[model samples]
Target: MYAVFKRELMGLLNSLMAYITIGVFLLATGLLLWFFPDTSILEYGYAELTGFFSLAPFLFMFLIPAITMRSFAEERREGTYVLLAIRPVTDWQIILAKYFACLVLVVFALIPTLIYYYTIYQLGLPQGNIDGGAVTGSYIGLLLLGSAFVAVGIFTSSLSKNQVVAFALSVFICFIAYSGFDAVSQLFVLSYFETVFLSLSVNEHYQSISRGVLDTRDLIYFITFVALFLIATKAVTGGRKW
Candidate 1:
């Protein structure tokens, strides 16, 4: 698993895809937080990244899929799935190794954002009046959200041999999972079910946790969501042998 993880990580660095994804993330966030005049982070006097955090999950609708689209799709396209199938590793190991590698890449991409925190710290009126709890909570929420998206991307990548299709499907699925429930909640026909629907929406739970509240229900929801997708991916891969 570690070998597979290292190989996958190294492969990402060798391609332009990783660079482009990271660059785009930084560029988009930087522009919103620093460059843009009206809604810039500086203009809001937000020592934390509430604005940036709010925009990240939406931006990741494209970025996470771009990073994960080729995970297994490219392998299958290259006719290497058969070769990988015969390896000593179990199918779950292979899937998880690849998933972990993608998660590592996502985490690495987020590391640079810490500089924004430091910058805000230095610029704050009290030289650090920032809400540390809120910032920490936001970062945790981002990781949970990104992990769920990564799992969704991996499952979609496992379903097809074409990377482009994988990317599109992954993005669509992530967007739906992230926001579909809230949309359902707004339907007049589902008025009675609004509470349940809203409870299921990823954005709802993310917002709760991002406020630094640390709700157990929200944490459980994210954990369950990730596990469900990972298990689904395992089942899909296992079916290949039958």
Candidate 2:
């Protein structure tokens, strides 16, 4: 597992696409946080990074799929997946290795955003008057959210040998997972099940944690969400002739 993990991580780092993906993510977030008049922190007149935290998940919907689209799709298309499947390691290890590699890349994209936090911290009227707890919680929520998206991406990648197909499917699923439930809950016909639908949405739990209060239920939901997709990927791989 460690060998596969290391290899996968290095492979991502060595790929130009990986760097481009991360670069684009950073560039987009930087523009939205500082340059864009609408979402800019300067326009908000607040030390809080609420705008950033609110916009990141939507960015992630596209970013994570781009990172994970080739995880299995490219391998399968290039006839490398068979070699990977027949390795000594368990299927779970391969899935997890690929998942973590993609997730680490997502983290690389996120780390630079800390500069936004620091800038806001300094920009505070009292200098460092920003809500540190909420920032910490939002970062944590973003990490969990990214992890779930990686799982979703890996699963979608396993379903197709075409990278574009994998990317599109992953993005669609990520969008639905993040907010589709909330949209469903808004329906008058679903009003009786509104609580159930909202609880299933990633935004509901994420919003809870972004408030600086961590709940075990949200943690468990994310864990289950990740596990389900990974297990689904394992099923897909295991059934293949490889």
Per-candidate local distance difference test? 0.89, 0.92
lDDT of 1 at 3: 77
**Model 2 stretches astray by more than 4 angstroms:** none
Model 2 lDDT-worst window of ten: 187-196
Write model 2 residue lDDT over 71-140, tens digit each, in one string: 9889889998788878798898999999999999999999989999889988999999999999999999
Q: After superposition, how far is residue 59 of candidate 1 from its true place, in Å?
A: 1.2
Please give the lDDT score for candidate 1.
0.89
Q: What is the TM-score of each candidate against the true structure?
A: 0.95, 0.97
Backbone Cα, N, C clashes tallied per candidate:
0, 0
Instruction: Give the C-alpha miss distance for residue 186 in model 1, angstroms.
Output: 1.7
Q: How far is candidate 1 from the true structure (C-alpha RMSD, Å)?
A: 1.6
